[model samples]
Structure formats: C-alpha cells, structure tokens
Target: MTRCRAWLYTIICFALAGLVTGCWDGVELQRRAVVLMMAIDPAPDHPDWVVVSVQIARPQRAQPPSTGGSGSTSGGNKEDRPIAVVSREGRDVAEALQTIQLAINRVLFFGHLQALVIHEQVARRGLAAVLNPVAQSRVVRRQIWMFVSRERAEQVVNALPVLDVIPGMHFTNLFRNQIILRRQYDATIGGFRQRLVTPGVEPYLLGIDGMDPRLSAPRIVGLAVFADDRLVGWLPGDDYVGWALADSQFPRLDLTIPCPHGHGQFVVNVTRVRSRLRVMNPDAPRPKAVLHVHVHGMIEGGPCVQKEREADIQVLSRQVQQVLAKIIGQSIQKAQHLGTDVFGIGRQVYRMHPSAWHGDAAWRQTFPRLRVIVQVTTRLDYMQTYRQSALLYVDHEG
Candidate 1:
C-alpha cells in the first residue's frame, strides 16, 4: 500500500507541473513604462501652469551605473536618446499629471520614481497644491526624496548627458549618503511634510542650483530656506550644517578651529553626542528653552603643546566647549533673524504647554523673539600616549 501511494503522488506532481508555467502574466521591460525621476516646476511665462520632467531607464543601451560614478552614461547621441520630456498645464496638480499622461507614448507609472524636485517659484507659492497629488497617488512611493531647485525643473532634467538611464536613482543615492554621513540638509518629502503640517513646526527643502550649464551634468550649489510653505531664501552649505546639527540630524561633526598655540588649526572629531530640550515657564508671558548638549570628542590633529596631563585636558575641553557654544549661538541667532523655525520649537511648546497654546496669538508673535540657552560640554576621553605626562622643559644653565 505504501509503494502504491508513493507512485500515485509522483504521478500527481508531474500532472501539476505540466499544467503550470512561470511568468505567464508578467509584463516585460520593453512593454512597461519605467519611470526614473520626476522634476516639477512652475510653467514658463505662466505661474498657474506647471512643467513636469520625467526620466526613464534605457536598459537596452547600458547597464545601471556602477556604485560610484556619474549617473548619466551616454548610449547614443544626446538628442537621439529615447527619453520622454513632457510639459503639461493645469490649475491643479492632478490635472497636470493627467495632462502629462496624454502627452507621453506609454502609460505613466511612478512606482520607481526616485526624486520629486520642486522649483523655488512654485514652492514659494505654497506646497498644498503640490502635495495633494503626491498624497493621493498609490504609485508614488513614500520614500521618494524631495528637493527645491533654484533653477527651473525643466533645466535640471534637460541639462543631462542621459548617462545612467535612471536619474532618480542617482539623485536619491546622493541625498541618502549625505543624510547618513550627516553632512547635508535633512529635508526628505515625508519629513518635510511632517514638520510642515504638524501644528507648529514648518518645513524647509534643500535649495539646489546647477553648477555649470555648459557641463554635461549639473550639480547642487546651496539649500533653499522656507518659512512654512513659502520659500524665504537660500543658505550656503556650511551655514546649513549648524542647522542640521541643532535639528539632531547630524550625528557626527568634524570642525576645525584656529588655535594660536597650534600654529595651523585644531581638528576636533566629535565621537559621542547627546542633547536635551527643556521648556521653562511654559505658561508664562515669556517662554525659554534650554538646549543642553553634551559631546565627547578627541583632537585628531593639530599643533602639540607637549602636555598630556589632567590639567591640560581640562583646558582643552573648556576651549573646545567655548568654540562650540559660540557657533551654536550664531546659528540660532541667524535662524531667528530670518524668522524661520527650522528647529521645531513651536511643536515643543505645543507639547509641553498644551493649555497655554489655546487661542495663543502671542506665541506666534513671540516665536520670532523666543530665547534659547545653548550649553556645550566637551570631554576628551582618549589620548594617543603611554603615560600621564606634562610638557617637558630643558634645564637652563646658570
């Protein structure tokens, strides 16, 4: 009976295999519309209408870009490459997207879309209209990073060598590395919206500008500053770092400070960092915040004073603390002067003093005038030395 059952099962397995075949319903790469990146900007000569740039992968011509190289690789003459650039006009974002569909040959799909860049002109108008379509689209991935371009979206798309085929993939990788390395601004679309619509905190996007129009590919120059949904201005990369650190997004920082004793300058590499936010007098006429930051770091390279004693460590730690304190103060003052709350202090206030926030017009007026006390504590944990020692001086002859 066992032998008969085994033979019968074998026969059934073969019959099932004969009836089934893999990929019977799969769509081939050539048949589907593969989108790479998207760029949206205000239409030329008309603020009401907008232009959309769509980049698609050309799999037949080249392999995907290797780990570290320029994104666009030319498979053929620049103009002859089979890519789509569609411009559509509509009062609303959905209408414009639909119009783009009609303009393109293949059905437009955005599941693989890499980045969504907004032009400064449209971002300045406000992002409510722009975000409506993104939120409703099932094809749009939530993780797609967003940026604000100082140049028109059309220019950013067209000014490419069409190298890697998937421009969005390249752009996303660039921003992701910056975020992980804690070097650039943190303004992903999801995070930006969270900060923008979450009651009090506003949002800002990285302001991008083309490096050289004549070059084959363009690069970013600066970051865009926003107040709520309006584009306020642009901040250079270095100034933007301070804001990133204050926002708790920058995990590691290596800053150089000029020390007269060190001839050149001292390079401090921050190894460990902790920050605490305190709300003081939440219900009072004036609200205060204490940004208590404790950082542990070591001097990587600089002029040596030839001392490695406890007293020397104390003096070095105090000096580094003072430098960090001044930098944080300047950054906070600059953001306040611009009337931008990139730090989300407003949300902090709402969380701590819910009752006081009710019908509080004064908070809005006072937000630009709020006070922040920044305290920096630096500790030098290690020194590349054998024994605890002080500076050695040669004996003088009488």
Candidate 2:
C-alpha cells in the first residue's frame, strides 16, 4: 500500500513540473517590438558615431463602433499605419541599438528583419564596422536583403511604402520583382558574407535611391561595387545589365540592333542566355580569361530584311552577337579600369589554378593586367506571329 501511494505522489509531481515549466520563460507577443528593417548611416554630428534606424511593426488597435440615432459608428476604427521608425546614435552599431532599446518599452526583436540598408556615406567610409555587429548578432538572419542607399539610410527606411503596408516589405517586394525581371543583381547578407571572405571575388550590392526630396518611395538605381568592404564605385543603368550578363544572372534582355537593310533599328528579345568563363595559362605571369555567352532569342517588332530569307536571319543574328560582345566587353573594361573584380574572374582562376593564386594582394595586381575576351553567339530562332512584316504584306498587296 505504501509503494502504491509513493507511485501516485511521483505521478503528481511530474504533472506539476510539466505545468510549471510550460511557457515559464516565454515572453508575451505584446512585450516584443518586431523589427522589420534596419538602416545604418554615419552620424552627421560626429564622424565616428553611427546612426541606426529600426523600423518596427506596431500592432493595430481596433475601436468598437458606436451606434446611435445619429448613425455614428466607432467599432473597428483604427490607425492603418503599420510601422514606426526609430533612430539612435552611438559610437558603433551595437551601442546605437542598445540606445534604441532603452527608448522602447518592449524588447527589440530582429528575427523578422527583412532588409538592411547602408547609407552611401557609411558604405563609402567602409561597411566592416557596421556589418560586423550584425554578422555576430544571434537574432539577425543572413538571408535578409542588403541595399546601399543613395540618400540617408534613415530616410530610405522611413519612406512610406506605396504598395506594401509595411515599408520593409516594400523593399522586399522590389528585390523579388527585380529578380523576376532580371533588372539588377540580387544581393543578400548571406551573399555579401560569402563574397567578403572569398579570396578572389569582390562584393557588390544593389543601389537604391529616393524618388523625391521627401522620399515618397525608394527605387533601385544601380549596382554598388565594393572592394573589400569599401564602396569603390557604381555600375549605373545599362552598364549593370552587361555585368548581369557576364555573371550569368540575366534571364531576359531587350536590345535594339541596326536592321540588315540599314533603314532603322529593330528589337531583339534575348532569352535563355548562358555564360561560361574559362581561364588559360594559369601559371603564366599574365593569364587570359575568356567569357563565352550563348543567347537564343526572337525578333519581336523588327522590319523584315531580304524578304524573310534565311540569309537575313543570319545577318540579324550576327548583328545581335556583335552588340552583345560590345556590351560585355565594355563592362569588363569598366571593372578593370576601376580595379574591381566584380566579375569574379579571379575567383575562377583561383578555383581552376589554386597554386597560381598567391593572395588577395597578388590577385589584385594581376587582375587589371589580365587579358579578357568576350564571345557572344546569338541564334534567331523564332519570328513574331506574322511570317513577314506587316509592312511587307502591305507592300506585296500594293
């Protein structure tokens, strides 16, 4: 009978322990400030100090509607604004974050951080100091999108989103669309981290600029090139598209080439672009790198040359190949002139010929002098819905 009583007591103790431990350390959702994005800028007053702006989602409060003879309703009315921007300054990013936490009643949570924006000044000065803390943080995720703002990072973060209820999500959707459209490079904290440590590759981020003085919205403008951690320069406008082609990230591109008949320009919609890089004479003092790009495309709104003959297609294809080669060559020259290896050609050499790569310094010295060749082949497979140009049909009928 004593043994049975002891067993019952043990069972009760186990149940009590389980009940006591459940949610013992979990904080209530209301007590947490969910951070959606963070922006880092160099403090204007003090050069050494950094300004950190955090965008937190504020929970909406619903008010009950009031019903009366006057027909006034108050229920379900609430402020639609979803985010609050807060800023703090300190000697470093961590200290700035600590100061920000002191101002908020709830604990700041970074697990939901969607974007990280660095001001142009901060990036120009160097990102190592600002990014080091984020890299070390346990709550921050590496997959968050990273962008360099042409204006103050705070302004970019605080801008009201036109499409998304949350400002951070606006930036997220922009990047998503950019990837789908193949308009710019898709940069993330994880990708940056990998490139930063890689021996031969340099890091780059998508550049974003405010549309107006008030920063009603932010738009991606170009690519920011980084040597080590410092912003070296930018690849603006169509120049970045060429870089994208070399990087093999270009999904589709539209180009205008001179018509074979020399009357006007025609549109070529390039798709299925494939790029390959080859390094030759790895042991040589000056090595050669060749980039070969194969593109399959169709003529979408172009005048027909040579009565739609097969020779006309070859001529058009050759013209497209020449244009692509020129663009890719120009991009490579620009990178070489800037002394930045945005193409990761050095990385290719390092992978193919590890013994040739002495160090970063050596690679940098050899990169500018390395000979690069760009070869582009374009195949015109499909013409538009009409077998011949509409103009041609009219001319034949006439």
Q: Best by TM-score, which number?
A: 2
Off by over 4 Å in 1: 1-31, 64-76, 79-83, 159-165, 180-186, 212-223, 260-262, 304-307, 359-362, 385-398
lDDT of 2 by residue, 1-398 (tens): 99999999999999898887566666788999999989998898999889999989875621222344544332322354567789999999999999999999999988889989998888888887788878787878878888898888888777654444666776687677655234232388878878888988899998888754332456788789988888988887767777887787767767777776688888887776778899899668767887887776778766654345666666677767666677777777777777789889889878988888787778877887788877776666554422221110000000
Q: What is the TM-score of each candidate against the true structure?
A: 0.78, 0.83
**Model 1: ten consecutive residues of lowest lDDT:** 389-398
Model 1, residue 379: displacement in angstroms?
A: 2.5
Q: What would the C-alpha RMSD of candidate 1 be, to one decimal place?
A: 8.4
User: Candidate 2 versus the native: TM-score?
Assistant: 0.83
Q: State each model's CA lDDT, in order.
A: 0.64, 0.75
Best by lDDT: 2
lDDT of 1 by residue, 55-167 (tens): 76555644442332554444445444545556667776787878877776667667787677788888878887688787567767666777788777776555444344455
